[model samples]
Target chain A: MAQEFIQWLSHPGLNHFLIISGILFSFGIFAVLTRRNAILVLMGIELILNAANINFIAFSRYGTGTLDGQVIAIFVIILAAAEAAIALAIVLNIYQNFNTVNVDELNQLRD
Target chain B: MDLFTIVFYFLAIITLGAGAVVVFSRNIIHAAFALLFAFFGVAGLYVLLMADFIAITQLMIYVGGILVLVLFGVMLTSQVLDVQMKSGTIQTFPAVLVVSALAGTLVGIFWSTPWKTTAAAPMEVTAAKIGEMLLTSYLLPFEIASVVLLAALIGAALIARREKNA
Candidate 1:
């Protein structure tokens, strides 16, 4: 069993990348679910986006011979940037309206 | 282990460790700094995947542009540095339980599924091919993405701007 595990570690196949992406994705989810700050939540969203990008690049390299996954990853990156800009602007607005940046305190819309 | 495997392990550790810091750090400034390492590590992983162009783009756009903007946002906010910068979480136990369950399910699916794999081919310069595809096959998406970016820039500026009289 020990030798088998060593061999698995040395190969560094698709499953390894998948596992890394999975862990990153879960961490992002945890941050988004639990964090009170809006900006921190945005960072978690970025983490989720990066995890998806990793999965895309890994599959593109290992699975199909085409560059479709890479192309989609590029698009995803572009969208992520745009999303971050708009989200941060909204967060700034939130801060301006309320004295705090905490999501829990922004309960005025909780009708 | 071979050099490729060794490098992969190192990059994975850096990326995941930085990500943990980003998620769990108390100070927002420290989390932003940790995010820089996480983005850098992801760019390194991009190199390992042979997506050289995407790797460079990730470094340039993510590390250079968005992270700086995020840091500015964190610093410019009032009282961010003095006090109330604590990024506390509510219901941490439940969140961890849910996240762990989801991660386990994802890992199981990843290992059990039969992914289609092909032999590793010789590395070729992918930037030119990606550029060509952006122009030809994905021309519409390419143009649309630029337009979206333009709109986002304008919208963000408008939203964040303050009234002169106020």
Candidate 2:
């Protein structure tokens, strides 16, 4: 059974990519949930995006051999860039105002 | 088993291990830098998967562009070292429990589902094909993406700029 598992590991396939993506997605979720710092949370979000992209590319390559998944992955990358820019800017503003970037502490609705 | 499989395993380990550091590291700077390797591993995997265009894009945009931006965010916000740099986790038990459950379900689904897969995509220069698709079938989204990028650029600048009235 152990040798069979190793054999399975060596033969890379759709399921392998999916499992890795799943693990990465879980890591992102853990970061998003646990980290008090907004930047760390953003990093987790980036991980999640990467995980999703892996799935897309994997499906694109393995499933239909279509370029649509690759195209959509490109779009997703663009969106992630925009999101990072905007989110970091907001985090900076939050830091400037509150003197801290701890996400939970920035929870009050208004001044 | 083969050279390809070996490379895939190496890339997967780098991706997941670096990703773990990014998520679980106590130091925010460590997390930020660890993200660089995670991005690099993903790019390598894209290459292995024959998505050459996406792999290069991942390297250029993710490694060159976004990672730099994230590092800048880290440098600008955190002062000096040690005290403010520590990124502590909150509600650890719940996070672990929830994440483990989610991951287990995803893995179960991925393995159990008999995916419809053809032979691996023929290794080809995908940049030209992707470009043609972008211009033809994906034209609307292509144009809209540019617009969205413009808006984001302006918005980010507006938000991050020093407040003169303060």
Candidate 3:
């Protein structure tokens, strides 16, 4: 039993990572849906991005034939930083105009 | 299970649980804390994947920098006490429905696909190789991303600094 389990552990496949990424992605979507704060929404978005990053790095590590996945992960990180900067700016602007970052109150477009 | 598997499972559980709390918590500060845990978990995952450089970057950037920024935003904007913040109504039913559907679709796609490892020979490359690629073949995109960050910083400063005497 020990030997069998050890062999399974060293399989070097991406399935475990994929499953974890999928769960993280789901949790992120849940956060995006239920959270009322704009900043929390941005956190959710970051979680989603991190999930994608995990997938990229996993594929890069396991497949290793091409560097494309690792390259993509680098781009993803840069894009995520850019995204966070713009998002925070927008959040700040929203707070300035309304003095609140609660999503439910921004209902001018809800008619 | 070996050490790697043990660590992977532990980190994975922490990440998923913390992520759930991030969405489910009513107080924004608590949510931010949970997000920090989730980010730390991802960095752990990076270590498991043997991307030590990327793992360190994830820890520094996501947990240290971005999360701090988020917590600052939360503190700057909120007036309620922690107890008051804890009672805010988060719309539930619609959110649950949408999230469940999304999870189902994603898991379905993941399960249906037979993920085959590409038959290409493994490259014995390092983070140095990646750095070289970024500077050479990927230089154009790298430069563009830097420009975008510069623009974002300027824009953020411009939008955030209100005219005080106006």
In angstroms, the error of model 2 at B130 is: 0.2
DockQ of 3: 0.49
How do the residues B36-98 of candidate 3 rate in per-residue lDDT, one tens digit apiece?
899898998887777777878788778777887787787767775534455253767887888
Give the C-alpha miss distance for residue A91 in model 2, angstroms: 0.4
Best by DockQ: 2
Better by TM-score, candidate 3 or 2? 2
- Could you give candidate 2's per-residue lDDT for residues B38-125 as a string of tens digits? 9999999999889999999999999999999999989888885547678778999998999999999999999889998999856899
Task: Kindly report which residue pairs in candidate 1 clash with one another.
Answer: none
Cα lDDT listed for each candidate: 0.90, 0.93, 0.78
lDDT score, candidate 3: 0.78
lDDT of 3 at A107: 70
Top TM-score model: 2
